[model samples]
Target: NNMAEAIASAIISYKKEYFGSQADVNYDKTLSSKAAESTKSKRIADNKVLKARNSNVVFKVQFAAGNKKIKLNPSNFKGLKNVSVRTRNGSFYKYAYGDTSDYAVAKKDLKEVKSKGYTAAYIIAFRDGKSISVEEAIKL
Candidate 1:
C-alpha cells in the first residue's frame, strides 16, 4: 500500500508538471494523498516565486541616504524627476532617481545624478521590489 501511494503521488506530480495548474487531483481521505496534494501545491508556489524573481529587475541611481524621510518632490531632489524612496529599517530613507530596466540607461542617469551635486551617487538594482546586488541583477 505504501508503494502504491508513492506511485500515485508521482503520477499526480507528473501530471501537474506537464499539464500545469489545470491538472486537478481527486482528493481522498487518505493521509498520503493529502501529503501529495500539499507537496504539489508547494511546488506550484515555488514556481511562482521563481518567475517573479526573474522578472521586473529595475535599476535606480541612488543619490541620497539619511536617517530622516525627505518629502518626495522635485524641489527636494534638485529638480530630478522620477525620484523614489526606499526605506531601510524603519526611519532611514534612501532616495534614488529614475526607474529603468536598462543598465546602460541607469549608468547615464547616475552621471546626471552626480552632476546635481550628489557626488556619491551610485547605481542600485532591485528584483521584485527587493534590493539585489547589481552583479546578480546582471546575471538575472
Candidate 2:
C-alpha cells in the first residue's frame, strides 16, 4: 500500500522539479517498476533545458545591452559557440557568447574573448534562462 504511495510521491516531485509544473499521472497503479522507468524517461526530456548535461548554471559574455532599436549581432563573436542574444526586460536586449557550466572555464573564456578584441566583455551567468553572477552560478 505504501509502495504505491511512495512511487506516486516520487513521480510528482520529479515532475515538479524538472517540468516546472504538474503533469498527467496516468501510470498503472500495480506497476511500481514501470514508474521508475517513467521517471528516468522524464529526466531525459528535461535535459534540453539544461546548459550542460551536468550543470544547471552557465556563464556567458555579455557584449552588448541597449534599449534602443540597435541590433545585436552574436555572429560577430567568431569561433565561439552558444552565442546568443536574449531580452531581459521587455525592450532591452543583451548579447552574450559562450556556454560553460564551469566557473573557471568561464573566467578563462572571459580572458580569451577579451584578448580577441572584446575589451569590455565580462562574465554573466545564467541558470534556467535567468541572469546571475558567476559566484551565484557556480553555487548552483
Highest TM-score: which candidate?
Answer: 1
lDDT string for model 1 (19-135, tens) is 443222212222355444334433443443222235589888776655667788889888998899866455556678998876667767878887888765666779888877565
Most accurate candidate by lDDT: 1
lDDT of 2 by residue, 25-54 (tens): 211222444334334333442443333344
TM-score of each model, paired residue for residue: 0.59, 0.50
* lDDT of the candidates, in the order given: 0.63, 0.53
Query: Candidate 2: which pairs clash?
Result: none
C-alpha RMSD values across all candidates: 19.1, 16.9
The collision pairs in model 1 are: none
Model 2, total clashes: 0
